[model samples]
Target: MISSEYCRLMARYSTWQNTSLVNAADGLTNSDRWKDRGAFFQSIAATLNHIYWADALMLERLKGNGRPEETIKHSLASPSNWDDFKVLRTQRNEEIEEWAARLVDADLNGTVVWYPGDGSTRMERPTALCAVELFNHESHHRGQVHAMLTAAGAEPEPTDLSLVP
Candidate 1:
């Protein structure tokens, strides 16, 4: 199980890494950004969009809402435009941090239940695990974007958690 303090720390780390990622990626051309990189999400923009969508989805569930309307298939839906994407990306990052800011121990000690994008079946998990997974999911996709950025010759800042300051 995780604690509120852990979520807060991870949220800060997320903002730090995201700022670096966006700054570096801004230097790339549209074709370069959207070029198929053969990663899971296929390209930097798509992957980043998926990351943002995942954050929104997890945020709704964490806030006791429900699965987001946007599904995994449509994770890349919206703001293919860099400027708009940046705005929404920053918003989702801030939202994640804000949600983490309000977490209490009791909040993470319980369970969260929801269906996946397909609503295939009901899924239930410890709130603590979901809390941990939120950050985990971000890092997972961001790492893909990080690699894509680097391969395309963009320079994101160091991602070491200790460097989060």
Candidate 2:
């Protein structure tokens, strides 16, 4: 089982990395941020939107708040405006920080039942496992955003976990 400390650390690290990415992105023009760079999400804006959407979805599941009516693909199209995306991203990061601070060891031990956004099908997994998946998913997509940022001449801060403060 993952420890509460681990979850807390990942939460903080995610917030730091995300802030850095957003600040770097803000320095660029909309055209640069939205340019298709051939990544999975195609552009920096789309990739960042996807991350925000996934975070909200997973957070809802972790909290047993039930799934939203929209599918993942539909949600990924959110924060469509650059200014709105920055605001929503910051808000979500704060929400994750607060949620992590309240997590206890027991909270991570039991099974988490959630609708996987594929019609009526439901999936179950250990809470710790799901938490790790959420964090890992952020890193996986942030790497793509980081690459896209660099390709667009925006230098995001280093994302080494040990270097997070």
Candidate 3:
């Protein structure tokens, strides 16, 4: 259902889109970014935090490098400030890119077992599926952030994957 090439493309696209969104948010004042816009996550900052949180969770599952407990802990907590968020976000993007660069067919075809962070049970699924999920998840939350950015009068760069350079 997925391939390394596909994963690589999506990874690059995800990084590109994320950078664009973060840059757009950079234009807003701290108060404006954190203001309650009545969105699902209540604010642009919260929504972006959620995306970063999920990215860390899924990346750990995919890469098996980070401690799940620690990743989940930080993700559940909001960044101390925008600078912290951007730093972490940039670091995670680089990690994702590195992982995608080294990915292989076998890696994508393999399965990963993990607790769904609910503490109720564990689930297993193909790495490819999880990889796709990561990209899909980012795009989903980014859509909300994009709307919020526009609503806040900040013009974000275009989001089309084909436009990535």
Candidate 4:
């Protein structure tokens, strides 16, 4: 079982990382930020959008609800531009931090059931495992964005967990 303290700490880390990345990315032009760099999600903007969508879904599931399904491609195209994304991303980062802050030790226990992007079957998994995945998933994609940002000559903050503040 994971403690709520872990959730709170991860939430803090997420906020620190998100702000650093968005700030760094703000230096790039729209075309530059949206250019496909052959990363897994194709571009910095699209990867950020994908993370935004999936994080919302995971948050809902953590609350025992399912979000409307959308294709991976749809998520990639979501908001379709950078300005809208930046606004919504700020809101989401706050929501995620709030949710994590509200958790208690028992909140991470038991299983959470939710449909995937396909929305065909209801799969169940331990809440602790899902909590881990929730933070890990964003970190995974953010790493891709960080690489793309740097390759585009945009400098994001260092990603060391110990450096979170």
- Candidate 1 ranges with C-alpha deviation above 4 Å: 70-76, 118-120
| Model 2 Cα shift for residue 84 (angstroms) | 1.0
Question: What's the lDDT for all of these models?
Answer: 0.86, 0.87, 0.87, 0.86
lDDT of 4 at 123: 89
User: Per-residue CA lDDT of candidate 1, range 1-165, in tens?
Assistant: 678999999999999998898899999998888899999989998888888887887877888765655433465465689999999889888888998899888889888888776778788988899988989988988999999999999999998998789
**Residues 68-87 of candidate 2: C-alpha lDDT, one tens digit per residue:** 43544565656768898988
Evaluate model 4: give its lDDT: 0.86
Minimum summed lDDT over a 10-residue window in model 4 is located at: 67-76
Clash pairs detected, candidate 1: none
Among all windows of 10 consecutive residues in model 2, the one with the lowest summed lDDT is 65-74
In candidate 3, what are the lDDT values of residues 48-103, reduced to their tens digit? 99998888888888886434755567457789599999998998898888889998
The clash number for model 3 is: 0
lDDT of 4 at 51: 87
Candidate 4 C-alpha lDDT tens digits along 62-120: 88885435423345448776788889899989999999989999889999987776678
Per-model TM against the reference: 0.92, 0.93, 0.92, 0.91
Root-mean-square deviation (CA) per prediction: 2.2, 2.0, 1.8, 2.5
